[model samples]
Target: MADNRFEVPEYFKCPLSLEIMDDPVFLCTGSGHSFERNWLQKALDRNPFQDPITNIRYGDRLTFGPNRSLKAAIEDWKQKTNYHSASAQRPPSPPHRIPEPPRRPFGPFTPSLFPQPQFTPPPVLFAPSFFPPREPVAPPRRPRRHFIPCSPNRLPEHLLSRWEWLR
Candidate 1:
């Protein structure tokens, strides 16, 4: 049964799966029908070289291609409708917060073996007048001649003139 929450277009669904196709494909059965690739593959696996809708036997000649237009249309529809899966639509479960263990105060009567260290604030340092202001560093320059030198022995007599300029 189809969910009544969002009114999905009739054409957006696969005829076999009755679900929105993630990867819609067109069967070359001359039926002008589109189906979800997964559903079509499953149908083909069961029947072997046959169209699920028309039940037309294609034998070894069975072929299909991605229904790009239909996929785009479905994506557009989903975006416009703000459609999300049932799992995504459902409210997230509340996170369980674990309570910290109660801390026992170490009084003079109950002396601890290890003493807690005192935290001191770090001192801030001002830049010295002797130091110059920081400047942006430029990247290393590349060699002007980027071409690789080819062996003279490998070059033809006619092409040697062009290769001479590279030297």
Candidate 2:
């Protein structure tokens, strides 16, 4: 036996009409509270039904939903508000990898197309002298430290000598 009772989900129930809707209208709003565009304009110009709140007639706004009035429409839209916001705030998925385009064949009239080189593992070489006996030498000793004393007054004399050389 087919279950025929209209046991719709709580979210499916239109907030405005409190009834099951068919082609529900979703409002893309800002701040998750206010509608972004002129709801009246989008409802009138883009919609097919008249504004329920304003009592204005619009052709494009009328969608194939169950709700009739604008208040009813807004009600249906409100139910999906949380869903729309969560989906919008979620990070976008990474792009899918597209298949590479087919390569054109090289003909006699065209220049010989060279195939891309493949990775080739080099042959490992071996030698009996690889592990040769080592004759180690001792490290050289450090040289004695040498310190030269200088005065601040000598700096100007050094600069003067360089200036005289320039002349």
Candidate 3:
């Protein structure tokens, strides 16, 4: 489910309504400059160049116009929020493979536009290996060492000298 709450950027919000502004305008007050154009114009008509919150008076000299940058920021923010909300919904999956319709077997002598379907085994669901298991390889034999006794008489003549140090 998509998240219910989405926060609008403060910069994209109207100073008057405190909501996101679709058509933002700057009211030429040195105080809070951002306002939704139509909403503020109504306020401006009631009282000349006065900001209700900030009563600093510019009289008839107040200058204001569409806030393009703030509007663009609002558009970008809206796109991202909508994209995230859209992603929460599950996407459609590919169509399943439909089983072919059952048909009468063609007589051997019958001429047909479609070739006779060959019988193929239904696909293996559980088998992971495509090829058969290879024969188990026997490990190579290691050369065996002759067991010579520690006794002096049993020692080979060449090994007798080395065993003398042990004596």
For TM-score, the strongest prediction is: 1
Clashing pairs in 3: none
* Regions of candidate 3 where Cα sits further than 4 Å from its true position: 1-5, 83-167
Number of the predicted model whose lDDT against the real structure is largest: 1
The lowest-lDDT stretch of 10 consecutive residues in candidate 1 is 146-155
The number of clashing residue pairs in each candidate reads 0, 15, 0
lDDT of 3 by residue, 1-167 (tens): 75644755677767677877879888766565788888888887887777755777774756678888988887887787773433356797789999998686677787776777989999888676867889999999999998868678887798889889756
TM-scores of the candidates are: 0.49, 0.21, 0.44
User: Whole-model Cα lDDT per candidate?
Assistant: 0.83, 0.48, 0.75
How accurate locally is residue 96 in candidate 1, as Cα lDDT from 0 to 100?
94
Give the total clashing residue pairs for model 3: 0
Model 3 C-alpha lDDT versus the unseen true structure: 0.75
